[model samples]
Target: MASGALAKPQMRGLLAKRLRFHIVGAFIVAVGVACAYKFGVAEQRKKAYADFYRNYDSMKDFEEMRRAGIFQSTK
Candidate 1:
């Protein structure tokens, strides 16, 4: 009877340790997914900007605006 009582506490402790490890692993995976999502968004924005600048008409319009003094002076 004394041995049975001792075994219950040991089992509880082991279960608590496993639960903690599982929680930590889940948190790590969540952080990794968030980082990947952020990187993907940044890459997509960069690609979009690159495509916008690749068109000759856009560059010509920007140059015209610059000559017309629409942008702030650099001093």
Candidate 2:
């Protein structure tokens, strides 16, 4: 009977440890996924902005605006 009582506490301790490990592992996985998603979004935004600036019409408009003194230094 004493051994049975001891076994129960040991089993409970082991189960608690395992549960904590699983919770921590899940948290790590969630953080990794969030970081990957944020990195992908940043990369997509960078590429889109680069493409926008590379367009011929955009370049022409920029030049026209500059020549019209829109970007003149106020100093």
Q: State TM-scores per candidate.
A: 0.45, 0.44
Off by over 4 Å in 2: 1-9, 46-75
Report lDDT (CA) for all predictions. Answer: 0.82, 0.82
Each model's Cα RMSD: 6.0, 6.2
The residue-by-residue lDDT of candidate 1 on 1-75, one tens digit each, is 455544445664798899899999999999999899878897889989999878759667878888888888721
Model 1 alpha-carbon drift over 4 Å, by segment: 1-10, 46-75
How well does model 1 score by local distance difference test? 0.82
Cα deviation in Å at residue 11, candidate 2?
1.0
